[model samples]
Target chain A: MPIPLIQLAGVSKQYGDVRAVDDVTLELEPGEFFALLGPSGCGKTSLMRLVAGFETPDAGRVLIDGRDMQGVPPYRRPVNMMFQSYALFPHMSVERNIAFGLVQQGMAKGYIATRVAEMLRLVKLEGYGARRPEQLSGGQKQRVALARALAPRPKLLLLDEPLAALDRKLREETQFELMQVQRDLGIAFMLVTHDQDEAMAMAQRIALMRSGRIEQIGDARAIYERPASLFAAEFVGEINLFEGEVVQSGEGKFAIVQGGGRIALADDTPLPGPVRIAVRPERMVMSHLRAGSYAEFAGVIADMVWLGDLTVWRVRLSDGRLIRISRSNADAANAAFSRGDQVFVGFEAQSARMLLS
Target chain B: MSLVKKTRGVGDGGLAANLGRRLVLIVPYAWLILFFAIPFLIVVKISISVQRDGRPPYEPVFELADGFIGAWESVQKFSMESYAAIYADRIYGDAYISSVWIAALATLCTLLIGYPLALAMARAPRRWRSLLIVLAVAPFWTSFLIRIYAWIVILKDEGLLNHALISTGLISEPIHIYATQGAVLIGIVYSYLPFMILPLYNALEKQDTALVEAALDLGATPFAAFRQITWPLSMRGVIAGCLLVFIPAVGEYVIPDLLGSDEVLMIGRSLWDEFSTARNWPGAAAVATVLLVLLLVPIVAYQRSHLQTHGAAR
Candidate 1:
């Protein structure tokens, strides 16, 4: 395997009473797009800052290209960060801002000029070299900031909530621009974002942070379909959970019974206590006619919302438990169910996963 | 009935707003016309008039006449004798030259001292920044005369500064600082230190700290970051602080009178001698008018540049 471009080993940091970043160990390979995904105050930004050398870890080491970065100041570190605010120098022109790092490194004036010109074109901001930061629009300023950070061409680039300041349309467009830049440069990119959709769209792998610790790290599909804990399941996407007892745990698949519904899991282990069955909302089929092929659940549609792309159905079981099911509005017939219709919801055995705590 | 009332309300509101906007523009301008502009024109008129031994100590350059021809004849009687007299006397030249030099030096000293303090206050933790700022301008809360008097107690021959120097063996004997140019400079810097720091802090505090961090993240050293980013960005503050210190320091009367030696002559002291002691009102007016013309250029330039950049910022 190729050596990782950056490695964080059991890093931890705290501010007064709050543990901003607990023990987190992660690795990024060359040209890898990694994301630290969490909500505000969850320590994802702190972890990125630690790697950028803005904040030192209280314990543990941050390794950049296999070198210890303990005593290295932010200026000396090879890592660069694109600040969330963009932090473009208002007094400087776009060309000067991009050339700042090269000039600091004492690069030749001729070389620096060409490099700045190249960066402007890379971010699709050609012919905008002489404009001051205040003269640019929000999206234009963001592109200038990206060009500035990438001018030095460091081994790894750190981004702290880079897209949070942009409008929705601009953010979507910039996401692809950022990925293209990373691909063209062939450097590892680490981003911190509270937006799950952004993380899913951009990063190849995501580490979900919860109160300074990584709860789970995997691809979006793995994290969404196979959650290891209840927090992971609820955080990534919506799921309908049913608590039940595992009565038969002999085969690889365990059988769980709750109320009048029996669910068979494809993969499970014997649990010390009762287990819960987690089923994704879109996995279950809802219909007025009961299918006799599998163990089916009969429920009444308690509430319904006709969204433009999908229809959300709230199904109440015979035992008074409510389960949310979403069906695509692909056809008019699929969304014909009303709030008072009697419906039978059923899922395949492969879709139900046993959740044991 | 409601629709009629709403339309009338809207019309009245728009009319009231228009009147309010006009009032906002008129008040300050009217104040300037009444106080600053007329008095300045009167001074200019007196500066060109001949001095005489009378109650007003000068001849009126323009006196209202019975008709247009008489008014034209009266206006033609204006003299350049006062300006010629100022040009002939080397004392007036010396006073103007010395004031500019002394004020320039004092302004430089205040800037060198104020920039660091303002930067420190701006970079300090948010909670402590307010306290530091308050302490920096705390001397302004007291009476100006009392503040100057308080400095006398600290810089005297047997004062606390001399006593500490002697006690610490940093000096061999008491120095003659109370009646020297050093004393005058000390007083000017102490008095105007707040003026320098306040504007600098205002400018520096408004700057986003993330700019400095971005510089560092771009691989610029701490000092380089300061030179490339902080220094250029805070230049407006530096210019403002220098102007605040330099303009008033040139014509300072109280500090020079209290702290300066007999040899250190300034335009303010010269104007005072001509007005109060010698009672040459026209000559003093000429001196004041010349000084105003000299200072007006810089003030207008400063305002013009500020307007240009402030428009760009918006």
Candidate 2:
């Protein structure tokens, strides 16, 4: 296999009493779009900083393109970072800011001008060359920042909460434009964001982190459908967890009983002792008549909210447990169930996954 | 009450705020007229008078005791002889040139020494910054004359500086540092260093360090980043500091009198001699007026340039 564009091996960093980045080993294929997804203070930004050479790992190594990057300053590194604050030079015009990195590389003035114009066109800001950063709007400033970071054509690019400053509509538009730019240039990108939706929408692969450790690393579907731990399960999306114990085991099938309800799985390997099953809110079906083919529970609609595209209902089960179920607005009959309506909540065996812890 | 309310529009702040705003503007103008403008006009009047053997030593340009017509006649008799005397003398020209040269040199020295010191203080850890500022201003706690006296003790031929140099074997004999132009320069720089540093520190401390990091991440070295970003951004402070040092140094009297040799004829020393030793009051007033006009050139230029930059920024 070809060498990975970026490789982090057992990297760790400590700040005073806090281990900002724990032992993390990761690799990204060339031209890959990856994300470090976590909440605030979860070390995602720190991990990006380590890769950018702003902070050296207290232990282990950072390798880029098969070369060890130790004792190298940020200026010599073959990577660039778009800071959260944009950090555009306030005194320089937009053309100067975009031409800064190329000038540092000692590119010719004529070529640098053409390159700056090309970058302005790429970011859809063609006629704003002479304006200072303070004169630009928030979204325009963000585009200028992106253009500046991409002007040098580094092997890898790092974005730290790049869209946190924009409004929702602008953020969505920028997200699509950013992905397009990354794809067009064929450069590897590593985005750091606390917004899970942004991470899922942009990154091809995501490394979900918690308490300075990578909880899971996979594509969005795997992380959402087959979460490794309870933290991973709850962090990605909304889910209904049923705590139970193993009551029966058979060939390629097993059953779990929780209070007045029972759940059966199709797995051949039987789990012992207490276990939990996690199912997404959209996976659970609600109907007036219970289907004989699925294991079901009797519940009453406790509360419901109607989102434009989807409707979510909180159902109170016979055991006094509240489980959330969501359905798309595609079906007209789905809106029939309102508060206090008696319904049967059922899930197919394949849709639920057993959690060990 | 209804008519008054109708007359007062929504945008207006009513009578109280208008009075308050007027007071804010009037107080400083009143102070200037009483303390500054009146005295300055009196000096101008004296600068145009004729020298005579009298209690005031100069013919009064205005005499209210002789009534309006008499005062008008005296005003018509105001002479331009003192100004002509200053223009004809080479000593006054040499003194003005040397004073300007010395002040310019001292301002340059302060800037060269103050820039790095201010940058270091700005880069220092946040907890130690207050202490550093306190230390920078600590010299002001002592009396100004006493501080100059202390410099004399250290810079004299057999002073502490020469003694330490001799003990370290750097020099075999005491050097003539006291009573020279170099001593005057040293005194000016030492006295005005805080003026240079305080404004620079204020400007540098408010800068966003993330810009420097962004420059480095874009492939610029630390020095290049400073040249491209930090220095240009702190120019306002540099100008303020230079003006603060240069203006005062040009008209300084006590330091030059105490530290400079007799050969270095500064305008401040010349003014002192004309007023006291030569007892030429009109000549002294003419010299002071010229000095004020000379200093006004830079201050007005700076103000116009400052307004232009601010206008562009807006």
Candidate 3:
């Protein structure tokens, strides 16, 4: 669809004996906001650099709009990168910084002036043309860097942890602003971040990375609801895992927990002895009474935390197993259980997914 | 009311202390005026003093009634003769031109070799950078005369270069490289090469390499990035290196004396001849004055520009 604005095939980059990015193959549709999410040194930034032509892959190829970027340098490539530090030239004024790429491309002086003015307005930094980067606040500097990266109108824009430098509140505000700009321009934006919340908030789809390979790639809700692997589940969001073994294999398979507790599965998949079941905290329902409507286990409330709008309950099952459950403020009074109180935790069989470890 | 009275008394004491501090600051100012400023005035006084024809280069019993008149008449009357004589002589004219040309050429050569070396030093690995920097400046630590003498051995007709070339079959005979202008230029460039390298290395090394990358990311080619960002940003070092090499090269005497033939007569040698052989103090002073005047403008300009740039950056 839309010719897949950027295509990366077998893009592996090595640093000496260490492979920073291993055999990454992915594509982004035009105007899609794609995020490569991982922890630090997990090769997310390395992947972005490869796409921006800053680092050449030791093997494999990076293609932008069906053209192989073999010998092409960063300047010649039709991609622009916004560095994490903003990397604004301190010697130049705000206007000059934004106009740098246009000038380099040999655009007419008048046209550059007009385009730079328009960009400054787009970023809502109008009338700040004469101020240097040091004179601006953190958010202003971020806007200037964004304007500069967008000034050349490249086919693909790479953002390397663009909001990492901003404060929490400012970062949240700028995330929406960045999303708006990407939508307005209709350009493919590839964002690299170790921040899961940031990725979920901005990107249409995410490529979650680990070590040197893509762990999983899917839409935000799919990745969160159904992670294909343990690493993907742990990386994307908080999940309570119960280590167990498959005792029966059929349409309604069952798993025996470590301490003789049983969990029924919805679908039967061929599996060896050891397996793990992952379930979201909110999916597990907690009640003071034994409802007896679904798979249930008796537990004691170990700890409780009130997080303004939601209450968190940590419950230890009868078999010495601990599970976390979150209840919204609207449902806080339903159980009314505090620490050291007895409760029952239950979940639907279809809600929990089994992950092979 | 009591506290106010005490504070007022303290304020009076503070005023007295401030006055004492101001007086203490004037001490260096007075010393500078007496030692530096007054000596320059004395030189002006002596230069304008008239010398009688039969007297021992001094005027005694001169009329104070004609005070300003005598100073003017003496400057006009007692000689532009030295100036005229120096310019009329072909040897002095030739020496002046040769010295300027040689220094300019040496400065150019130093820039050509030192710029790239400095860039390499700047981009070198951090662990290897210190070693490279020390190697670039190690030659300056050795004795200057020994370095010049070493050059003499290397540039001789049957010396290292010629011998190497002849043995390699690149030359049929030992070329006459010694006691020539080319030899002098080699000696000048070699001796002062460190002076060029150190400043340029400092400037290039201090540059933030991110700026270069930023330029390239903005669509500038590698060479364009270097020309637009690296070169202009390192200009302070270039200017410093040029001045360091050019100033001393202009007045160089030893290298020319040891390395060049009799055909190369430099201003330094001319000044030496006027003072030692010709016994012409006024003529040598005149030559010294001219050289000093020629140098003072550029040095002042360089210092002013340097200060202006630093001030602007701040």
Candidate 3 lDDT over residue span A1-357, tens digit each:
356778889989999788899999999887889999999988998898888878899888888888898888999988888888888887678999899899999999999999999999989999999988878999999999999999999888899899999999999999999999999999889999999999999999999999889999998999999898998888887888877777665646777655535667655555747877788888987878888755577889999888878888899987787888887878747457889988888776676767986
- lDDT for each residue of candidate 1 in A1-357, tens digit (9 for 90 to 100): 767788889999999999999999988888889999988999998898898888999999999888899999999988888999999999888999999989989999999999999999999999999999989999999999999999998888888889988999999999999999888899889999998889989999999999999989999888889887777787878888877676655654545556536655544355535877778999877779988655468999999888889988899998888888888898677757998899888776677666775
Clashing pairs in 1: none
Task: Summarize candidate 2's per-residue lDDT along A126-239 as a digit string, tens digits.
Answer: 999999999999999999999999999999999999999999999999999999999999999999999999999999999999988999999999999999888889989999
Clashes of 1: 0
* Error at A190, model 3, angstroms: 0.7
lDDT of candidate 2? 0.91
B190-297 per-residue lDDT for model 1 (tens digits): 999999999999999999999999999999999999998999899899999999999999999899888887788889999999888988777888899999888988
Q: Rank the candidates by lDDT, best first.
A: 2, 1, 3
**Candidate 3 chain B: 10-residue stretch with minimal lDDT:** B54-63
Q: State the weakest 10-residue window (summed lDDT) of model 2 chain B.
A: B6-15
Best by DockQ: 2
RMSD (Å) per prediction? 2.5, 2.9, 5.3
DockQ, candidate no. 1: 0.76
How far is A142's C-alpha from truth in model 2 (Å)? Answer: 0.7
Provide the TM-score of chain A alone for each candidate, in the order shown: 0.93, 0.96, 0.94
Error of 1 at B222 (Å): 1.5
Question: Clashing pairs in model 3?
Answer: none
